[model samples]
Target chain A: MRCQQVRRAWLEPELSAKARRHMQACPACQREWELNRRLNEAFSGWEVERPLPAEWDRRLQQRIATARTGWRGWLESWRWRPHPQPLRLAAGALLLLLVAGAGLYVRPRWFSPRAVKPASTGIVRDLQALNQNQEILQCPLFAGHGAGDLANGAENMN
Target chain B: MVIEDRLTGRLKLSADVLDADAEQMLRFQAGDETAFEILVQRYRRPLSGYMDRMLQNSPVSDELTQEAFLRVYLSRRRYRPTARFSTWLYRIATRLALNYLRDHRHERRQLSLDQPSPVTERPPEAASPAPGQEGEMLADERCRRIRRSVAALPERQRTAVILHKYQEMDYRAIGETLQISVNATKSLLFRAYETLRRELRDLEEAR
Candidate 1:
């Protein structure tokens, strides 16, 4: 139990009197204490020694300045601008409604019967003409007829 | 009138001392440009060190640190005083570091053994005893082994250990940064420390 307490203390570092006494007496706990200390030292030793580049501030400032002047800056500035929250929300909702309404209004025009009728009629007329020619070609009277006879027959039908 | 002015100035000073980071963020959000410089000065070193340790490359660390700051700057309008400013900043840095690690995992695995460990660049300045040069060498080898063991830890455990031990974050803050629960953060640190203890036990025994 003392050994377990010592191990827990190694992690939490809130040692009680019993754990402290155990650590002092037990060679194993003493070793564990030393190991914990070394681990901490290793971590501290990894501290960054190199300074940031001298131009870092200047470059960052320049970038920020440029950003403020560009289109991104415009967008961000507009984004950050203070406005009443409820007003902004209402505006957003209104914009969404407008967009949805426009989409809905435009949708039927694209697929409306009036818009489709002309092209559909042209297709039907071509199909009818094709069917008439096919029927005429299959007719027994026109089966062995020459071009002149076929034209005469077509004229008569017209 | 003068007494009232003095009281206002004292109150401002007290607020600055008590919550300087969040105060500065508020100031910057309100279009006070110089407040940002104060924030940059404050966070630059710690954030850079955190990145350096996580990525194991000083140059990349420098770049990512700059990027993190820029992100803060760019998103200034989105800043809220809901959490500690340091916690938010760390969340950004941690995310950047984790993304970099994930993307470069394959490249990191192929690193040459000839390359030096990325933990520390300079050797300790202490002079070794002339007769104990061999002992000094062994100690150096042990330190190297310890570094490798730490670097070999799984990503979440490594992150937890770094945040808890190195950054000195409380479990709650670490959990917030990692987007985990506080209990999970504690569990992660426990597992990580256990792994470190096992890996470095030989060095302890040798001594």
Candidate 2:
């Protein structure tokens, strides 16, 4: 066996006869075998002592029981978000894209872009609400720091 | 015990214990709590050790091992006995470990590994490399280096190395857990060991 084949097969659970024969002669394969042996021994001898609270089993059972029920199950799961952020973000983005894509695909068939009026937008509704926020309008600092620009921007979006 | 994949109807030649584990899983799915307990009793320590090494966080690993089992419990009905129980369990454990790593990538793990423990629990080997105090010191240093070297590997590589080296998983089982092909598993182990060899060259030489 060539060194390449020998190196690749060295880590297998069982070595082939040819590879085993080759390993005996090759200095590099010898080092690899030694390192592998040492690593195995170290791992076998190693122990991780992580002490848990006495009630761990109880808490786990409670969590599992709670998880099997209704709304409490949802609440329990919300405590630990094990899913990765990128996947969540991608899913969110995909949903957004899907909604946008569906809207784009459906809009032209349902109503002409020019025919649909912009008066019903959520931004317009928000601007109407902002237009009615009494405390926001009454604040002195709201007037001092270009809060009018904010109001204007909201109005423009509307 | 023989398990045939429903989709293919091919015999799954897993070991007798693994087949037994699959049977236990099936029994748990059939509403046997004792079967699930059996599985838990068997896997808890190994999974805890695996998660601890993966995250380098002892408390979190313990907590997460419970969560992993809980996940298995929650998804019991959904589980098909198409795979070996251990492989499927490791798949869940690996995903949880990787997800934990991703979630806390910014935070430094509080490592509780390499604690001072007696390594002489087992009977001494006739070919034991170390026997006396000097050998013990050397052994300690070697172990420390090994841990650090393993910890320093890239995430997937670290996982593959740990699964292969520590878990003693065969390539097929590891590939299934990592959701990679067996060839890919071999390549991953190769790269990981190459990196380890580079890291521990001095230790190798000292030996």
Candidate 3:
């Protein structure tokens, strides 16, 4: 038989007249045909009335439920998490903290009224004490001279 | 409403929503988890049965069936509904089964029927004219031999035969499920049946 005829008959078994003749004459083809028919009959009756295992149903349900919950929970947690770029968020926070610390450190150097006021107060107190001491010493010296002058006038008058 | 009615309502509504194929899958793609469950529930048993027939091993079939459903659920976002939903679902299952069979190239070790035959278990469809006389020792032996012969066919042939014969899918549907041309699907079925017939020739001749 021509290969094209054989191939064509192979594709459309119902349409091929030559293939039917070939099967009748060819022992191999007849056996092949019988085998195909019998296997079809045998497998067509392959039935099992077994029920689905209850455990499998339970497992599938549990898995689906867990998946549902897990997906929702992940979405919820994602909402609370900072948006866009976490590295940028952390960098911004760090920048804010550094700026605040530098301000605290430099504030004393630039504008500490309390630090200057205490030193000025101590200098003023020391100056006032020294002037009082000088006045007391000078007052005794000047009074002694004036009293002697008055006594000298009284003696001259007498 | 009664509890049963309420549950039934829910199931019916769910089935309706699921029967909306591309729409339900779209919902799944949009992260509707219930849509995924509905898909899984609708598909699991039939797909499992198909896998069981293909693998001929219950545990492996069970695992592969679960994997197939999971893959479908996970890949719902990629669904285009280019063909029927069932064809797409079976395509996923067929790929998983084929991959597994490929990975485990060694012959599957099945429990030998070496011991004395268990009680005769006739297939349900074989309703003998006298139902009472049907469950005989000979029929059970035949079922065993036939089962062994089916298990022995090459994987593709076995799958094609089971899908065509047992699943009752026509050539186009089988081709859709197997991701092959209709002609290839028919050829696979033809070869499978031919192999099985040769294997069980004695049984047929005896009958």
The best candidate by lDDT is: 1
Residues A38-92, model 2: lDDT tens digits: 7666665456654455777787788788777957455443343433367667876
Off by over 4 Å in 1: A1-9, A16-31, A69-94, A113-158, B1-18, B122-129, B132-139, B203-207
| Model 3 alpha-carbon drift over 4 Å, by segment | A1-37, A65-158, B1-20, B31-34, B103-107, B110-142, B205-207
Report, for every candidate in turn, its global Cα lDDT versus the true structure. 0.75, 0.74, 0.64
Model 1 residue B205 lDDT score: 66
Q: What is the TM-score of candidate 2? A: 0.64
What shift in Å separates residue A131 of candidate 3 from its native position after superposition?
A: 86
Using TM-score as the measure, the top candidate is 1
Q: What tens-digit string does per-residue lDDT give for candidate 1 at A47-129? A: 55668888888877877777778876767655844444777778878999999999999999887865344555788989999
Q: Pick the candidate with the highest DockQ.
A: 1
Residue B164 C-alpha lDDT in model 1:
81
Predictions' DockQ, in order: 0.26, 0.15, 0.08
| lDDT score at residue B167, model 1, on the 0-100 scale | 83
Clash count, one per candidate: 0, 0, 0
DockQ ranking from best candidate downward: 1, 2, 3
Candidate 2: clashing pairs of residues:
none
lDDT at residue B65 of model 1 (Cα atoms): 89
